[model samples]
Target: MPHNSIPVIETKRLVLRGPEAGDYPDFRATFSSYRSRFMGGPLTPYETWMLYAAEIGHWQIRGYGMWMIHDRTTDKPLGMAGGWKPAQWPEAEIAWIIWPETAGHGYALEATHAARGYLYGRLGWEGAVSYLDPKNLDSIRLAERLGAKKDTGAQTVDGNDICYRHPSPAQLKNTQISDGIELEIAHYADPKFRPEGYALD
Candidate 1:
């Protein structure tokens, strides 16, 4: 494969890399369905494009954004996982989405572990949180699976968006990624793939 400007992160069975046009169709389908209710979605086509473009644009503006999660065996895009920080947010957030077909396969849980590790290891972030709608039980459970705790003191958008703070840098000082996870984050990552001026290793 050719070199990617964005760093490619590998886990046990998936590849996390930059988003592209091929990922849009699946994304649109989710955002158009009830599955997206917690994400302020069920958006119109115009709104979907805007949200999709913003996700891609976030990488340009912030140097770190969501990665398209692809199955290593099939190389087919399954979902997305990574970080996002808009201007209004108090801190960056770890985010993920597993397509309907991949639901219950533990893909989001696995992909998120890699993404969170990347944020702390390569991105040089001191902390991060995952914001979810109060009713987004799936996301809340995922956050809990990642060892995140509900941060009631954190600020939210529109007095909503329950915040789940991930394991802090100090908390994950050791045992960051799971034992079964094989990360290509450091040794195989691009030397130039620094996020916001932070080195990969």
Candidate 2:
């Protein structure tokens, strides 16, 4: 069996860490907003708890999960980005979401690029996928921005939503991928891999 080699991911304005038990309130608040309902339901408190629990489980079971996004300056929680592999997906999925306040600021792209770098270059994951709703123009644009192509033949995870497949060699130019993190690739490829709290420990 392989060891868990996943490292915590960070961005210029955010920290992507594994979800903890205390994230329910923020998760509930974020997920319940109108901004979030377009992609998925605005979950109830219990539902938010369950979701975070599953996210943590993803890290434990699959070695990666939806990361808890925190503000780099104030350390306030913001949103999430990382890899997900539900029982039904064909490949590991790259997922991201930002609070409404954090929207339009490029947080999603930033966190996502970093997460992809870790998953592919460090963890040796070659195939990463993303599921998007056709109606969510913002997400589609982000997918294209990240070089993900629309998968016309891809099946939806739920009864709704279309799937988008990211090109293996795709790289977003404007998004920042930090150097000082403690991951294998960060230590080797990035000069700043362990920047501040960005360390894996």
Candidate 3:
């Protein structure tokens, strides 16, 4: 399907969809938490909603934007993971951030892997990019696991400017990964993207 025509995606334990007005409070809470400290200072509910609305608006204008990730069972939001084209980056950036309480559960990686595949596989994009802070070990590791290279070049945006890249598959194959977890990019635009028992609030 065309990129713009893609619908919500469902994963083993999550659901990926466009942002809604209802997401403001959750997003505000997530942004204020310690997990998101590196993402810039906390934003007010209105600011959070504005940012989210802009993301949703991207789908209409750019045919791509951030997709909110939520738990399928409890219907709680984990965070957002998908394609974004912020002005600072030269190419479309693949980004994801889980709420503080939800950290270390592999949600970011899972959501990101699926989003990347959708970008390259479904959207037919030539390539994708991810700009990360080198000191943010979690994000760095996640990017590496996805086979994304470190560009070394930095461009400041939202108080951060650091390594960036579009990693090759060979790079991914060469990396050693531990057991018990595997990454898959969530494709939100696919019709089959819904997780079991998922419902929008």
| lDDT (Cα, tens digit) per residue for candidate 2, span 1-201 | 112344666665667777766766777777776767765667776776777778777777777777777777887777788888879786678988877776655567667777887787878776677988778788777777667888878767885777888766434323331221223333323455423432121
- Residues 1-201, candidate 1: write the lDDT tens digits: 122577899886789989887789999998898878888879999999999989888888888999999988999888889998889887788988887777765677778888888889887888789898988788887787677899999887557788898877777665643432323323223335322432111
TM-score of 2: 0.77
TM-score ranking, best first: 1, 2, 3
* lDDT score, candidate 1: 0.78
Ranked by lDDT, top first: 1, 2, 3
Candidate 2 shows a clash count of: 7
Each prediction's whole-model lDDT (CA): 0.78, 0.69, 0.67
Off by over 4 Å in 2: 1-6, 170-201
Query: Model 3: which ten-residue window has the lowest total lDDT?
Result: 178-187
After TM-score superposition, what is the CA distance of residue 155 in candidate 2 from its true location, in Å? 2.9
What TM-score fits each model? 0.84, 0.77, 0.74
Candidate 1 residues lying further than 4 Å off, grouped into runs, are 1-4, 175-201
Q: For candidate 3, what is the lDDT?
A: 0.67
Among all windows of ten consecutive residues in candidate 1, which has the lowest summed lDDT?
192-201
